[model samples]
Target: MKVFTQFTDEEVRKAQVSVLELLLINHPLDCPVCDRGGECPLQDQALAFGPGASRYEEAKRTYRKPLPLSPLVNLDRERCVLCARCTRFCDQISGDRFIELFDRGGAEQVGISAGQDFRSPFSGNTVQICPVGALTATTYRFAARPFDVATGDTICPHCGDNLDVNDAWACDKGRFAFSFVDQPTRLTTPLLRDHGLEPASFDETLAAVATWCRGGRAAVLAGGRLSNEDAYALSKLARTGLRTNDIDARPFPCDPSALPAERAQATGGMAVTYRDVELAKLIVVVGLDAEQEVPILHLRIRKAARQGARIVVIHPRRTRSYDVAEHV
Candidate 1:
């Protein structure tokens, strides 16, 4: 037969009911103080598709409970809606399997394995995916109100290419990491070591550099640490201003040809938008440690999977994506 498949409205409604059932039984019904509160799938899905009232006695299920297994993770049982997204996270996406549910029925709650602690590098994401404040970060516990923080959308300079830091708060590492530029350890004045060493003022530095390039051959071997403005300026000077293409800030050892073209940049470049992931029926990430490389994407992927998208992870080495993903 010809390949064909489609979910009927009734089938879709049933799937929605299944999701709602999970929320009714599992979610703590608490949204305040959670980082994922605004970004919460449970909150959005339940409000739209779940029962407005509880079927079971609310007191029967755990709520506002706490598990102190990892300093990075704080498990509040009362808030857990028992979605299993967190435990699935550690197992399918991360391959850590550090966290899981204990007991059965109403007694069930999220936790690290008995006498153990969740300790994966990406373990912190569990706190972000938790439907309620049930799971929280020790580092971000009770931090500023979400509304008080201003967000900036910029790709992380570190790690692999494409990541949209959705609601990157002023308190986020993206902002805090800028401290190095203002730190005393930073090389504010250009220094040239005897084996290429010496400190010089801005003007002196320019003159010295000009003298080197007077021979008609010089290159700016910059790093990804530079801001987009700085990289663009240097590139302009080398390419347009100087009629040379030697100014470069290649981040990794990959091929130079792989860089996005200027046209692509105008159309938002080789960047993978959140819309791409959302619309995808099945996404296969091959040979990449997405957890270590793009942590936030994993969170969004979790959200997408919850919404019925299939995620496949095929990595040579162990990875966190191995845990939460559907087709691991």
Candidate 2:
């Protein structure tokens, strides 16, 4: 079939410019102080596609700035472009309909129902996906500019792409609970027991540890949060260097036979993937609060329920999945 895609077309270019102009009609001119200043998609697009100066001569619409939606998120109604990214994320992806577009015409804005807070475990995602500075993280508000901050590429320990877990999404805790690293009380240097936990250099600490390990038996008990590579390194050090097999990565003991079939599949390396959950006809969740514990899994279960799967959640108390699953 013959088709005409309108890229570089004069009419299409004019239409794009007009859309940018309309989007910026009520957008605040506070980009200097805005958290998303250098990294804002709206700002970049406006500079690229919008006219040199705005034709909006009338007084711009305004609202009370920086409304706290929850303890984690702040909303600026005037900066909102009404693209519905946050609202749609709540309603469609997270299944947490805490916020929605309110009112009509120019007065319309994103807001929560009376007495409701945007307390969803996935609420931070809205801020991450916002095109403008309308939604800003409370912990990260004005923390640093894009130019001031240095970034490093690292695989997230919480969720990763290999498993298709939390694909393009993360729970609030994984997304926003990083402020503790800057605390004054946080240990930046290793400590030695020369007197009473005196600060020591890494060389001194490692030498002391090596001496102690050589003099006596040593076993490695690594945290469960260690990455696969770290765990492997630790395992190698314990088995090869220390000549010991008394190394374990699990924080606690778990009986494989007691685990649910799906969990057992995972623990036993049998590969019960998220696709299995989506295609499941009947899913029985046993003693797992998937929403608070494993949110992405909860989302997958919800998606399955939407696609005609029956979900039964068996727990001591009700959970957030009660809306989509039968609570037992």
Candidate 3:
């Protein structure tokens, strides 16, 4: 078939519609409870281009969306615009087609075929792209609002060895993973093994910590997941304030003498934005399993495939994403 490289007058006419919005009139207005409320593209679009009033009736279509899509994400069909962004993501990016759209017409909606729990590792991205609150992250649900929360933009404190900060990244796990911090069995207060682990006064706790520091063999072990500033403060406290030679924070082995290789290679890596991935003529993965790790990336790669990118997979599970690619 001959390709239409440029928009023609007839094609433009066909694309026009009397509808004032890109979504169905039956969609819900649950932006408040939705995880994507602050950053949703659909909400933004509605403000600028939606009709003066909804054309839908209460009886036309109804469904309460959204249950968990996976451990990291949830799906609420009630708020779905049926954009299929989530479905395409699992099928094309995560290389796991655990979820799909079901039924047809106003009955049209998204869901897992067998009512099974979603188990994809990269399922978190589905919550990130859902134009509506249809998909949400389990870790972030009701944890805090984007506005109520404060973020300290700092560098990746890669194992807390006084690393340099070039670019700042948003905290997904820190903000969302509350189960670890708020577990019912968690020790919320300092437990004096002798004092019944009561909620001790701040001064009393400081004194105990100071006593622990008085000994010369005191060592510190830091995790890479710490923010750079927090790591630096810990390192400084151990080496300077405590005068201990046993200062350590890294939990895993590293070649820390050198810059973090993954970030260092970012400039040369396949650093394609969602839009760029959607527009690429060919998308090639270099040992990257987006579906297993980067669901948003996988979704955009799928979008590119839908738009005609020749998708090539250099990996195994990638055979799935590649199927969505033109030349798989």
The candidate that achieves the highest TM-score relative to the unseen native structure: 2
**lDDT value for candidate 2?**
0.80
Model 3: per-residue lDDT, tens digit, 1-328? 7655215554533333224343656666677876777777777756654556665555545665556666677777777878888888667655567888888986888888676777765565566667777877776787777667776645322222212222311123322443565678876667554545467767888888888778565788887576689988988988888888786654344333323444566666655555677788987664455543344466577677767778876553343466575543
RMSD of each: 10.0, 4.9, 9.1
User: What is the lDDT for 161 in model 3?
Assistant: 22
Write out the backbone clash pairs for model 2. Answer: none
Pairwise lDDT winner, candidates 2 and 3: 2
Task: List runs of model 1 lying over 4 Å from the truth.
Answer: 1-72, 76-83, 92-95, 104-108, 114-117, 150-163, 167-189, 194-200, 222-233, 239-328
Candidates sorted by TM-score, descending order? 2, 3, 1
Worst 10 residues of 3 by lDDT: 161-170
lDDT of 2 by residue, 110-168 (tens): 99988888989989889888988899998889889977898665444453322332355
Alpha-carbon local distance difference test for all models: 0.63, 0.80, 0.62
Indicate which candidate wins on lDDT.
Answer: 2
Question: Would you estimate the TM-scores of all the predictions?
Answer: 0.50, 0.74, 0.51
- Model 2 regions more than 4 Å off: 1-9, 157-167, 181-223, 226-268
Q: How close is candidate 3 to the true structure, as a TM-score?
A: 0.51
